[model samples]
Target: MREDAESLDIRDVTANWVNAAVLDAQIKERIKSLADLAHTPLFFGRLDYLHDVGAEQAEGAEGESFYIGRRHVHDAQGDPMVIDWRAPVSQPFYQASRKNPLDVRLRRRFGYTSGELTAYEDERLSDPAEAADGEHTSRLLQAEIERPRVGPMRDIVATIQPEQDEIVRSELGGTVCVQGGPGTGKTAVGLHRVAYLLYAHRERLARTGTLVIGPNASFLHYIEQVLPALGELEVKQATVESLVTSDAVPVRGTDPAPTAVVKGDARMAEVLRRALRSHVSPPAEPLMVVRGSRRWRVPAYELEEMVRELLDRDIRYGAARDALPQRIAHAVLVRMEQAGEAPDDRVQDAVARNPAVKAAVKAVWPPVDPAKLVLRLLSDARFLAEHAEGLLTADEQQAVLWAKPPRSVKSAAWSAADAVLIDEANDLVSRTHSLGHVVLDEAQDLSPMQYRAVGRRCSTGSATVLGDLAQGTTPWATTSWEQALLHLGKPEALVEELTAGFRVPREVIAYASRLLPSIAPGLAEVRSVRESPGSLSVREVTTDTGTLAGPVGAADGGTGAHGGTTADAAAAAAGDAAVLDACRQALKHEGSTGLIAADARVPALAAALGAAGMPYLSPGEETTAESRLTLVPASLAKGLEYDYVVLDEPSAIVAGEPDERTGLRRLYVALTRAVSGLAVLHTTPLPAALAGAPTA
Candidate 1:
């Protein structure tokens, strides 16, 4: 054959990609053998699947569904939402956001308020979950989307905050802090404030000099589009970890291979780098990891020895340590001893006052050195105080390593930007504070110890805080944000209680508000603002027997057994059957279901479902709802929720301090992810406190 076959068609020898020979033979066969083919279409129908929850087979009866093989599909022609951005009320908003970019009012109003809703960044808050009809906030979001992103900053102006917040926004201080609660729009206002800072101080500080500390990667994904919606680029965004570490990982353990995940890693890294440059570094700090990093490792020790160190050791800390209040100085010593915690010398110098530390030290040490305790910083080894407070995660409080930061962590910390906003400030360790400007989110969720951590990060600048004091949950819930507020140097200056509700429907918000304890009535604003279409429903099923343990009688229960009695294998089988049945029902919902087992060994139960031929999305897999069962270990479920939640625990044991401090919150977050439904199948009856919790 010639090098090029110009005259000859390449069908006969080529692959079966439908050549003339195949087509002709097929058509001939169809014409000769087929009868009454005119009614049939030319091609077979095809289906597109998106979620992990498998479809129910039609074998089941009405009102009762079976996941035999049938599928569910989204309505292709669902109503397209419209918001009037051209309206005059929305014009100023469009102008100001484009001018100032992410003007505070617009960011909070993005979901809760609508005025000619347009794109502020790259996302649409349009959702059926929100109230029907055009809300002023939603419309504003629309206007941001619809308006041209170019032009001077005078275009959209929306003042969603009260005069006081606007005033707070206007203030350009050496250091500033913002605090409050969830749905109070702290994160929204803070993000918008960054745009405002860039607009106001761009000439002085330069856009490159601004840094915005943000939450984790999932949260970054959660809010990634907010900036671009206003026709502005995402300013420097960094997680608190990235802000702290010279070389931080983006959502640890993700692959570095090329693709969307890689791009996200780069974005996370770049934003963090930019934030560091803007706040900590005069120039971009070397994007390389520093060696021989020292960290403080704290563990549980007898309170007696902690006091000796406070009086004797590095109490001669960075200049400010000289001003340490006796109470805090003492408490730090005690926590170091009894709690096996270490003094964050760096953090010690950062706060204006650390009363919690003072109080804790006083409680622990009381200026007495008892022969009963041995506390020379507990110098064995397994525990690394890497920086400071992360040392608490240890179960057995093993040996201690003296991790001294070489060249000072602050040298690099302060090497970047002058002002710092620590996202999730409450989670910050006892150490790691030092900033000209500081802001925090979810302040309501912080406990007294965490509050002290917040205090340590504040400086002389305006300390603006955000988070709903009413949104507090967990044992660490700030019993008194106000009393906690009094611990601040400027309590009165700290009184910016945001009254707007942006995330939940008034109903859902109201429903959640019921969970708030009466102690923090301050969150009544969110409850009052919540619009509801929610109702609580309950279902009961007998426990499964066999392969199951009995209901442990609660200490309060009348039974002599502090735990509930075991009913035997039938109870276990019944409860397992109940969960299986729930999973079947969960797969039918509009959203996905999450099955939280006590540990990773959920196969005995999960394998049953798989043996039933149900599809499943493995935990930590790129989860889509179409699969049958998605198993998630309770630990990995922190900060994430599912559409449907099923919690399975063979034995519900409330164990240890560390789990209570952090693990329970993870359990709570996972339990809250169900948007539509929740089913708890337990060998134990489950805690009464969680019985009627919100289904995500």
Candidate 2:
């Protein structure tokens, strides 16, 4: 493939320099995409049919054998060596079964070790002997799911389940919302859906563009390589903050919880609309245009009628303003025709640019700077109260008002929520550019207004929303996917629930599910398919004076600390020592290990790890073979995973939140990050919800 791309004669094929440059660039991109990755397999599965398939299904050839891979690969003779997984012929590889083989006689899955083929498993779907044997489970599939990781996330193209394939292959015209639990592969599904959409509608998406929105920078960094690994390189990734705010208006301050909630309400969108509309006023004087010694006068009442008509139409603020001048000039043209003078489009355009007409349009519909408009709405109390009269209550309005407003947009300390407000105002003034498709991951944490900001970007396209209701830790976390979809302007989108777990072990997810009733009462518990003995352990560490006394089992009654604290400072040191011990024990295993703790407890744990001479990396830092330990704050641990995890003080994690329910949700996220084993070490007693679960 690389040789074919390099051998292209760009200069000979193109007649002009512009076409030559475009062809050269295309050739370069083709060559880059064909580069072989050392440790990534070109193909992972094979399918054999009972008869020759149709030419359309086989991509211009009738074939019975197809090797399914990440991308299409063809030989010099133009015969396919491997079929793209997104192709129609490869659909049966993921969707085929014994009862409905989709005409497949045999299915083969290949296992690779460091990119070299090591083993192959075959399933004879058409044989009656295999049909009577009962359902088959692929050990190779389970092994691939249980494989350890040492860096950013990898694509799951080789392990996509049937249910996931349905969502991935859904049509591009409609939206999809995956209400999945932890380890349900929601993020992976959303990403693969994007890859599939790109493959299915390459030319359309190339012109319209696509994007992936994550919860935070760390989460985005962790999943940055997944798309590229799947042979997709044009998908853009960003956080909500990055999407709304630019370098010109960097976020430098934070709002109080109550203030942020009020600012992020959907009601605020209306308030901004009212505030921007307040800039338009009735014209106080007539518009008079002098064209070639002929003076035309437009009455003030007629001009006011034109302004009211434009406002009633509810077009964009900028668009209406631009149209006002032309509307006035059209009135002047009517007088010209009535006066028996011949006029054309040139005369009307000249009248529209006349100083008198421009001034009247300015007086009636002045230009509005989105940033300056938002600055006034926040800074001027009288202005805000007037627009927020029917929308916000007295107290809610008071909560969102800045205590000390800045003099200008450049000087204001903009919070993340405030940036969202500015974005809304900007959209009101001018329509936002729309993408072809957008994937919003970890969406439970977004507020209603943030959803609107994202919705606008895909207003003309579709979206894939992925989130777990049980993992919502924000003050304004979404209560239901329906409400969230409504805010996203895709209320009719299909909502699919994924309950089967593939990443987290059975024991670990079972233990984490105990908190579901407390955190998310309406949601179903995640049922993991993979089980490993000794995967969950809860140790109660005893703190005696300044020294650590040792660990007791979860069932044992060990009175050491309550409410995540000790009676003295020395006892706290003993708890830290016990956490350190857990980390050491986790490091003894394979793959990466994470030490997750409450946001407030990060400093103490960092000092302990440093004093003990144990090197560790922060969250989002790529894990290495020599350094596989990452110290993750509970706040940022929602989307990350590790082979083994040593969690500190669950009570502290709960106490760090603004309220108990949100705190428990945060704790729920920290509990499900382990892929292999979880050792929760705490001096305080476990929450009542988790105390009854079985432990190692």
Candidate 3:
């Protein structure tokens, strides 16, 4: 496949330089897509149909047999050697069952070790004997699901479950919201859906574009390579903040939880709309345009009527402003025609550019700078009060108001919420560019305004919203997927919940689900398929060691303070030691190990790890064999998984949040990150909800 793509001679195929350049780029992309990756098999599964399936069949074949892979591969004679997973014929590979064979006689799953096929399992879907017995579980599928995760996230095309394949293959015209719990492959499903959509509608999506929105830079970095690995390189990825941030309003500061919540409320959208419309004023003077040896006059009342008509139309702010000049020019043209003079569109356009007409348009409809408008709305109390009179209460208005407004937009300390506000105002002035499709991951953490910002990007297209409601840790976390979809402009979107676990072991997920009743009462608990005993361990440190002999403050560039009592210092040292021991034990395993701790406890843990001669990487850093340990802060642990995890002080993780429920959600996220095993160490008592959970 690679040789065929590379051998294509496009140098003399085009007649012009532009065509040649475009062809060259396309050829290069095709060559890249065909490049063979080391250890990644060309195909992972095969399907044997009951009879000859299609018009194009293998030479001398009785029943059609097709190999399923990530990308399509063909021989020199244009005969398919491997079929793309997104192909319609390959649907039965994932969805075929004993009860419903779908004409698939045999479904074979391949297991690979270091990219070489080591084992294969077959299920006779069409066999009546097997159908009468019961369902058949493939050992290869379970092994693939329980495989130790090492570095960044990988594509799940080969391991996609029937439920996940349905979501991935959904039509591109409608939006989908997946309320999947931890380890349900929601992230992978969202990504594979993009690959599938691009396959089914390549030319359309290529022209319209696609994007994947993650929660933060770390999560985006972790999953950055999944698409490329699946032969998709055109899709873009970004965070909500990055999508909204512009040069005029870069996020340089943060808002208090209360303030950010108010700024991110859905009401802020209406407030921004009202504030922006306030810039338009009724024209009090008449407009006079002097043409060649002729004077065209428009009455003030007539001009007022034009402005009123434009406002009533409720088009985009900039669109209406652009049309206002033409309206005035048309009025002048009417007078010209009434005077027995002939006029054309060119003449009307020329008149619209007239200084008198331009000045009149400016007076009635001035240009609005989105950033400056937002600045004024946040800075000027009277202006904000006028726009937010009924939308925001006085207390809510004060909460969002800047204590010290900067003199200029560039100089202002814009928060993330403020950037979203500017984005809204920008859309009010002009329409945001729409993409063909968008995948929003970790969506529960997004604010309403943030959802609006994302929805604007795909207002004319569609979206795949993926998140776990139980993992919402933000103060403005979405209360329901229904409300979230409404904010996203996709109120009619289909919502699906996935409760089956595939990554975290059964014991670990069961332990983590203890907090579900406290954090998300209405959500169902995840039913893990893999039952691995001794996968979850909770250790409470009771023994105290002496204080650290070295200065612990050096870890965070703080002065060493040894002012605590002997017992306090000893207990702190002992807790640190226990966490270190847990990490060491986790590192003894074969895959990546993560030491997750609360934001407040990171410095001390870092000092402990350094003193113990343990080298570790921060979140988002690529994990290597020699350095497979990553010290993840509780806040950044979402959307990240490890083979083994050593979680420190669940109580501290809970306390890091603004409220108890959100805190418990954060703790739930931290607890569920383990793929192979989990060892939780805590010196303090567990939360009431987790107190009754099984411990080691």
lDDT of 2 at 349: 93
What is the C-alpha lDDT profile of model 3 across 239-283, one tens digit per residue? 999999987678999999999999999999999988888889998
The order by descending TM-score is 3, 2, 1
TM-score of each: 0.43, 0.96, 0.96
Q: lDDT for every model?
A: 0.38, 0.88, 0.88
Evaluated against the true structure, the overall lDDT of model 2 is 0.88
User: Model 2 — which ten-residue stretch has the worst lDDT?
Assistant: 549-558
The CA lDDT at 445 in model 2 is 96
lDDT of 1 at 609: 62
lDDT of candidate 1 over 1-696, digit per residue (tens): 111223345475557676767665544543333222221111111111122212221111222111111011112343212111222122223333222322112223332112322332321123333324333334444333223211111112233344324633455563334444333445666655554554445454342244444334554444444444332353555544455333321222221112111111112222222222121111111111111243222333422233344435533222222333443344444444564555565544432144444443333323311100111112323212222233233431231222332242223222111112122211121234444344554455444433443445453334455554444433444555465564434465545555555332344334334434432543444422333344222234453333344432222321223233345445544655666777787777544566766443354556656666767765534224456457765544433335556665522322211333233433333444343445555554444434564442
Backbone N/Cα/C clashes per model: 134, 0, 0
Q: For model 1, state the Cα shift of residue 612 in Å.
A: 6.6
Ten-residue segment with the worst summed lDDT in candidate 1?
65-74
Off by over 4 Å in 2: 544-569, 623-626
